[model samples]
Target: MNEELSARLRTAAEAHQPDRARILARLERGMSGAPDRHRESSGARPWPRVALASLAAAGILAGGGFAVAAIVQSPPARPDNSGTPAAPSAPSAPWTPPHTTPPAPTTGGPSAPDRSSSTSPSPEVSGGTVSARPDSAHVQDGPLWSAGSLDASSNTYWAQSDITLKTTQPLTALTVELRITQTGAVQSTGHWRTLPADDFTVTVQPEGAAVVYRWTLKPGRTVPAGQHVFAGQYNHAAGRREAKHDGYRVDATGPRGALSVWGGFTPAR
Candidate 1:
């Protein structure tokens, strides 16, 4: 019975409320030929909200794709704050091995001249004479006093006299003096000296008014022998092949008919 009474109460409430038709009628009146308050208040349709949400989602996706593309694809290089781009470095060159040859002996004898390398002495001035003098000489101990023995005393002796002459032909009357000295001997006397070649191998020339004479010392030999004074025509000169005890080499090519070389041995100071 109580259940029945509650049902009746609900029925009564329904009866007092308007029917669906009446509700429809009220809505039509509010909407008929007039602006809708709901539409006016919102200012736009509700569907636009959905469209805006979709557009926003698309924009976000595009921006994310662009960011990913910048990382994967070529990215613009950033410049340094100094406004200059960095340059790539050059690669290093490969190392080469050092050449291997033993260094030449440092303390060996005089190097042999390279014959293959054509090397000539400086062109000697024509008609000029060059000579050499000894810097020092020593008298050997003991006396086997021969003219040659004087040469032994002269071991410390050397002759050097350089003369140059510029003449159309060889100079005539070229006089060379070889100063001989003896020590460790009981007595000092004059003796004869010799030259290597007596065929006027020693040439003379006029280097202006001054006559220049030159003689080269042969290897393993010291003094040149023969005539003391060499005199002859510029083209054809004569020398002494054999010297006399008086120390004079015969020369027939002079105004005196015979020119003599003058020299002697003296006590060394």
Candidate 2:
């Protein structure tokens, strides 16, 4: 009912045009005592009252026109949809799978080694690989289990020769010698043996144009039966040096007969 009444009001306001001049002229005439036909035909209504009524009606029409203009200009309100739930947020990111180790990257050349895929590239052989087992020689058999090799750290300027001996029986006497070929400016730098320092005599000397490092057990000093090392260190000219001509000798005597072993150093593979 209210909406219908508002519609009618708006229509009436739009159809009728208020005339200020005509209304004012009528008011002046009425005020001057000129009879108003409508007022007389209807019951005697004062001119002032009629003028006020006209003004009130004009004001009402002006207000209704302004209200209609506002209604037309304003944007429509959005319907309330907060009551409806939002679409289930994209299924909450597909259940993430547990982390797994990634595969190693493949290559055209030998695939770069991967610790995850295989074992870490065997720890880089330092300078080169040095065999731990000695190149066996029956030069003079002894309580065997002895080995020798050039150290892996050997480079152009320096090198180390290692002799590892594992004696099965105590020794009453022992002697070891390592010779370095007389290459460019070849010179003995040092020598070491696992036997107690005071138990053996160590010497590094040049013999017949070759530098020889020797370790000899002192009289009455019983060489213990176990693994022992006799390493000879030397310096030579700056270049890759080979120990093909270099050699070592080990002689020992225990409760059994005296025995000895001699062999040449093999270039590290």
Candidate 3:
């Protein structure tokens, strides 16, 4: 009978057709059979065997509970977006310092414009110059420069405070000539010309140097004041024609009187 009861309990546990009520019924039958044996043996039946069987059945139920718990706790696997296995934490990129290159040097200075290879003359305007060696020159206490202009407009000029030589030659045939460029450049060659006495003015001041007629710039109907013609050679030039001077001056009463002069005016085109 005990074997038959054990067989029934096993079938209830393993059978797919057995419901919860059937399994409970098999357990009740097995428990009742042991209690009856003890009652027939005057309360002394196989107690140890019954206890072992009960323990075995409890173990099977516990195992089923554990299996259900494992199914609920387990999580489904997911595909990784990155090809490589992701590290526990991505390390921060190495720190990089910014460039430390020095700034370009400044380009500011006080030099004249670059004209080493230039052949053009100086501009005929104020505060300007051409191909002059020194930035400025001095005038002697005697005659600085002389020019002739009859055009009745105003003339402009520049003069420095240095480089004037007292004339050693006597005033035998004192004919002063001045040369100036049409664009107001002071040339080294035939730019100088002698001025006719009528077209020029000579003012000899008592205090300082005397000023001969300076060139004057004017309109079409009028002639610059210093514009004139002289019939003699100037600085060993040919016979006279209409001529102009960069500037001109007469010596003061003193022996070393000189004039600082430069021509810097031009006729309008």
Candidate 4:
């Protein structure tokens, strides 16, 4: 029985030894494979990271190049059929103002008749009575008188004519007409000379009973009846005087008859 038991125990021990050897070999192989797998995994992870970094760099470079190209290039211009550049538009014409004509001057009213050309009509005389006649006839039968004198000493004088007429009837209207001329003589030579119309002035004042009516002379042109109207100077070195060289006449008209008187003077020698 002891021999039999020993045989069984030997068989069991042999089987158990073979199984333990196989398990230990398998564990050693598994341990060595685990380090190789770890190295492979770590290497593979670095490859993926390098590829991502290269892609990102390439993308950045490409984006930067595209941005530079966009910045450097200019916008395209429209094509023109004509080769010559379009002429700059002409500057607008300067504005011009229109010209206007001036109006003519206006005259106040109708012009007066020119009396400087011809002499007035002469007077008519009968007995001691005298009357003013039209230009057609003349009558000579009355006494004439002279007033004042013109000499070298009399350089200026205000010569006046006053007359009292004798008539059969009372006189309603009377006019005294005096004709005067301006004369001057040089102080050194004493040569007498007559002044121009502008150089001297004449005015009338009615005595007795008569108011001045409208004047026969031009309106607004004649001097006032009592004021001094200066005639232009004939000679700068000459003395001037109011001379009645042409003489004066007084006419008194009434219902009975018209009476007139005349007077004048030449330079006294």
Clashes (backbone N, CA, C under 3 Å), per candidate, total 28, 3, 33, 4
**Looking at model 4, which ten-residue stretch has the lowest summed lDDT?**
225-234
Best model per TM-score: 2
Instruction: Please list the C-alpha lDDT of all candidates, in the order they appear.
Output: 0.32, 0.70, 0.35, 0.37
Q: Write one digit per residue (lDDT tens) for candidate 4, span 1-269.
A: 26663454345444533244443334434544554344444424445544555565566445544544443454756658878687577899999988878787678787777868444355545344332222222222132122323443443422222222233344344343433333332121212112223422334332222211111222223222121111111221243443333343444344546554444444544
List candidate 3 segments past 4 Å from native: 1-50, 59-263, 266-269
Q: Which model scores highest in lDDT? A: 2
TM-score for all models, in order of appearance: 0.23, 0.48, 0.22, 0.23
Ranking by lDDT: 2, 4, 3, 1
lDDT of 1: 0.32
Clashing pairs in 2: 134-147, 134-148, 140-260
Reference-based lDDT, residue 156, model 2: 85
Q: Output candidate 2 Cα RMSD.
A: 15.9
Return the TM-score for candidate 2, rounded to 2 decimals. 0.48
Q: What is candidate 1's lDDT per residue for 47-66, written digit by digit as tens? A: 65445555654654455445
- Per-residue lDDT tens digits for candidate 3, residues 33-102, read 7553344545454676556656756765666445444544557555488787655667899999998999
